[model samples]
Target: MRHPHPLPPPGHAEVRIVAATPEAARLIAEALRRRFAATEQRSYPAGGEGGTRLHLTVDTTHTAAAPRPWPATGEASGARRLQADEI
Candidate 1:
């Protein structure tokens, strides 16, 4: 049997969006534009012998880059638990 494609890491993802109306599809594509390198929407004829149908395909994919070095030369800085009185 065929297996589904596995997802990437937490910072990486792929999305395939399909909508009947242009407006609805555009809204989805716009919202996710920043998270992906490219968002492409296209029209295609429906499978039938009669009239054509309107459909939108919004396909986008994102891949995370390699980890970068810390900016500072000192030890790492992180948050610490505060005392009850501090709260």
Candidate 2:
């Protein structure tokens, strides 16, 4: 069967994320969103067993190239560092 939303030419790709629940599928898709320029996700039922299938297209040529570096020791960013005892 033909996919309803076909990926645009060469630089784009189709990504499918399948999981036992919609929330689980979305969590993975959310992680992809942080690393690339992607389309909004579309979800569908995977099967009779209640799984979720999510689809989205990502632009390979466009990405989050410069992610912010982690603040050294948290104190550098004025955030308090959690002490091991807090855990």
Tens digit of per-residue lDDT, candidate 1, span 1-87: 555966554544455555555555556665555445443555444345332333222233342233456545455434455557886
Candidate 1: stretches off by over 4 Å: 4-13, 45-87
What clash pairs does model 1 have? none
Each candidate: RMSD: 13.8, 6.8
Q: What TM-score against the true fold does each predicted structure earn? A: 0.34, 0.67
- Candidate number of the best lDDT: 2
True-vs-predicted CA distance for residue 62, candidate 2, Å: 0.5
Model 2, TM vs. native:
0.67
On the 0 to 100 scale, the lDDT of residue 84 in model 1 is: 78
Which residue window of length 10 is worst by lDDT in model 1? 50-59
Per-residue CA lDDT of model 2 for 1-87, tens digit only, reads 888965578988889999999988998898778888899999999989999999999888898555656666555533576789897
TM-score top scorer = 2
